[model samples]
Target: MRFLVITLIVHRPDPVTGITPSARDRLREVVDSAVLAEELGFDGFGVGERHERPFISSSPPVVLSHLAARTSRIRLFTAVTTLSLLDPVRAYEDYATLDNLSDGRLELIIGKGNGTAQRELFNVTPEDQWDRNAESYELFRQIWRQDTITAQPRYRPALHEAEVWPRPYQQPIRVWHGSATSRESVDLAARYGDPLFSANVTNPIEPYAELVHYYRQRWAEYGHDPALAAVGAGTAGFHVAPRSQDAVAAYAPVFAGQLAFQRSMGMEPVFPTLEDFIERSSALIGSPQQIIDKVHRYHEQFGHSVLHLHAEAGGLPPAEHRASLELFQSEVAPALRRTIPDPPWPWAPVLPEAAVTAAAD
Candidate 1:
């Protein structure tokens, strides 16, 4: 595993402390976290897009563009851009612009977003979301590959001989389809020969493993190389401490509080009880050795090259949150890297270190 630190930019009262950071503070924290991730030798940093309450990351491109100006080596990603809700033409233009701004270090993981509130916000029904995602992705891919094209879709107008400017630095920028227990998402990724990213945060291993297996099967059916099947997985949470006991003692209450809040809001947590949560959920809240073992088990199931962790959640305090990241980078992440290979397309164009150093000055 190539480790990625992902954040939802969650803005809510901490179930433990009842404190939330200000919007200004949150923005500063995001920039600080990106910089720290690069310094800590993390391969990627991603921001999630959520249009509903308790989430502030509505504009991932804007946030990523800012981080691009500040970091040189860390790859930037969108955890999952809701392709079903946005116009493909607009997304293509903006991401292509971001590609240039970041010196070509951009990877998109597209998905039909979760949360009923988000669907209502975009006036998209659950039944129609998948179709929208398929249509939008088809147009988005075409927009990147073709210079001028005509597209006629129900959601968007026809573009006759239309051209989008400032093409991306990488010809056909890398994209991964984010799949969450949806065969449609898996099939779409397979048909396109793109990578599949499993949302393993909210479910048991069997469902996600089946989807990954399905993705590989479909890849072969689509005449793609089975050996080249690329898959990524997301972890629920991460924390590291000197000892397993110390780690659990500190995190268990926080975890339970967060779960209770989710339950109170009518959401179903994958793990109901605190004990089951620690044992079953993908959350890696323990010592470095424990975390490494857990990741190894998951690797056997998913065969994922990329593994992402949501280290901060439920409005944890900045000091506590940063400490967890510090410990993880110092102790756990390096071990995982030794086990998994780098991204297949590591040679993708990106800004040079000298350019970023000079820009900072």
Candidate 2:
């Protein structure tokens, strides 16, 4: 299976330490984590976009552009670019430039953003956010695929033979639709024949597993090849210890913080205890073997070949964070890769699709 390290760039007091890193330092940590993810041989490193408090990842293109310069091989990802709140033209310009800067190693996971603060900030209502997301992406996809675009979109001004510059490095960049308990995103992804990325973090396995099933069903219903449908799943939390008991114990405080934060949002806790969380909730907390088994189990249900782990250290000590990730690469990743192979990508593995087509001609 392919692996990615992704962060929402949650900027808050350390749950364990009660100390918050300065904004500058927090941003620097994101850079360092991307560098480390590349060094550890992870397939991709993603930074999320959240226009709200307690998150500093509002500008994924800028952060990913810096990562492009810092690393050479790992693909850069936008966990979810929040198309609902963005101007697609501006987004296309930024990401197209980023694709060039990154030498065409870019993939996107686009979604209608959540949170009341973001919705109000962008003046997008719940009733229309999904419509906005679908419309924006339809325009964004055309901008990437065509040199000159002339179209009328509801959410944005009409374009007549418009030529957006920095023409993409990729012929048409690969996009993954990110959805959490939303059939709208799933339907859109299936309709466009794009991959689906399940936000498997917030809930139990049943919901995400069912959504993957629905995505596949919809893919077939849309007359797309079932074999071509791809899925990626996210982890709720992650830690690997030499022993199961130690792993649970080591990760207890992190879970406590998570529980408290969930409550502070005035939401009910799904998994009330750490043990239940590990047993359910898609969090990989246990010995290496246990984690490997859990991932394989999820694979059976999700049929997901790509998986993401939290890149942020969160409440864990710096050393513990580094060690746990190192251990995962050393022990857990190899096993999963052998058992679950990745689906083939539509574009050329190395060269951009444009380059490949040019060579063929």
Candidate 3:
């Protein structure tokens, strides 16, 4: 199974000390975490995009470009690129350039992002978000696959035999539709035979599992090979200690702070307490064996080949966070990797000859 370390780049005070780092320090930490992820054998590192308060990830391409310069092998991902709010032409150009700069080690997970603040900033109505996402993706896909394209899209300016320059390093880098609560995203992914990444953070496993099952059903309905329908899942949180009880104790304050923050935003959490969150949600807080067992249990429902855990601690100290990651790398990951098989994917970039022939005449 492929493992990814992802962060939303939230800028919140430390739960214990109530101290927040400077913007520069926070960004530096993100870069350092990506380097560490590569050193620790993670397959991918993802940076999220959000244009709201408490989030410093509004510019994913710039952040990922920095990561590309620092790391050689680990794949860089946009946890969810908020494509609905972006112009496909500009988005294509930026990511295409990033693809080249990263030597084709770029993958995208696109979504119609949540929250009213960002939607308002982008002037996107809730009614039109899904349609915008679909149209944007179709145009972006065309831009990647063809040299010249003519598109009369509803949400963006028309394209007239346009050639978006800086051809991608990967002939069509893989895209995974980020699915949260909606079937529209799932249907879109299935229609294009693209992969799906479940935002398995907010709610219980049943809803997310149902969404995955729905995605598989639609994949077959769309006549794509079942073998090729890949899926990935994200955990709410992660921390591992020498003993299960120690992990629970260590993460309690972090979870409490997170819950309080969520409630302050007028959002009611399903998992109200740390124990409830660990037991019910996808949060992986326990000993190595406990984490392994929980992953296996979720895998039974998700059939997911990729799993992403938070790279940065929400409120835990840096030392404890690093220790948890080290324990995961040394103890939990090896066992899971042995038990789970990777989903079928074309990892290598398409041949130049193939891309040339595939391009528009």
Candidate 4:
């Protein structure tokens, strides 16, 4: 299985102790954690975008470009580029430039973002977001693949033939549809023969598993190879210690803070308690064995080759976060990798020039 590190860049006041990181510190920590993810053998590192209070990753492309310069091998991704809220031409030009800089190692996951904050910020209606997402993606895809294209849409003017330049390193960088409780995203992925990444963070597995099944069924119906239908799954949280109790004790405060923040925002708490949260939700907080078991169970439901884990959220202390990541890489990752083969990503395997030179050194 391919392991990916996903970040929300959330910083919430401590529900129990009332402590939170400064905005500057939170941004620095995100970059530090992304660098560490590479050192720890994660295949990909992605940052989520949010245009609201408590979230600092509103500009993922800038952050990812910085990460690209700092790290050599790991693939970089935007967890979900809010395509609906963006101008398609600009988004294509910027990310295609990033793809060239990253040497064919960029994956774009597009979505209609959750929450009303972004919609209000961009003056988009929730009902119209899907239409915007579809139109923007169609144009973006053409911009990547075709040298010249003529297109007209509600938001864009007619183009006789416009060529978007600094074309991507890859002929067309892969796109994964980010689905959060939407059949529209699933159908879009199926229609385009792109992959689907389910947001299983805030909910249980049944709902998402059904979506994956729907995607596969539709993919086959669309005359694509069912085996080529790639699906990626997301988890809520992760904290693996030497013992289960220690893991819970270490992560509970942060989890509690997150739950409280969610409730304060008038969003329903997905779990009743921390214990219940880890058990039912995709929060993988436990010992190595327990984590391994839970991931395997999710694999059965998701049947996905890539499993993304959110180990750092709500601004957990940096040191504690590093320790949790270390334990996962040292103890949990090897066992999981041994049990499952890596996912098929055509752009995943090229070695960076630095690695080649280092071997000579």
TM-score to native of every candidate shown: 0.92, 0.96, 0.96, 0.92
Question: Which residue segments of model 2 deviate by more than 4 Å?
Answer: 346-350, 353-361
Per-residue error for 186 in candidate 4, Å, reads 0.3
Model 2's C-alpha root-mean-square deviation from the true structure amounts to 1.8
Q: Please state the error at residue 217 of candidate 3 in Å.
A: 0.3
Query: What's the residue-level lDDT of 76 in candidate 2?
Result: 94
Positional deviation of residue 267's Cα in model 4 after best superposition, in angstroms: 3.0
Cα lDDT tens digits for candidate 2, 87-160: 99999999999999998899999999899998999999989999999999999999999989999999889999
Q: What's the lDDT for candidate 3?
A: 0.92
Q: For model 3, how does the per-residue alpha-carbon lDDT over 1-361 read when each residue is reduced to its tens digit?
A: 8899998999878766678889899999899999999998899999999999889999999999999999999999999999999999999999999998998899999999998999999999999999999999999999999999998999887889899999888876899999999899999999999999999999999999999999999999999999999999999999999999989998988888887788888888899888789999999999999999999999999999999999987778888999999999999999998998787965554446655677645
lDDT of 2: 0.91
Q: List lDDT for all candidates, in order.
A: 0.84, 0.91, 0.92, 0.84
Question: Which residue runs does candidate 3 get wrong by more than 4 Å?
Answer: 346-361
Which candidate do you rate higher for TM-score, 3 or 4? 3
The top-ranked prediction according to lDDT is 3
**Candidate 3, poorest ten consecutive residues by summed lDDT:** 346-355
TM-score of 1: 0.92
lDDT by residue (154-247, candidate 1, tens digit) is 7889889999886776676788999988899999999998999998988778899999999999999999988778899998766667788877
* Pairs in clash, predicted candidate 4: none
* lDDT, residue 78, model 4: 91
TM-score of 4: 0.92
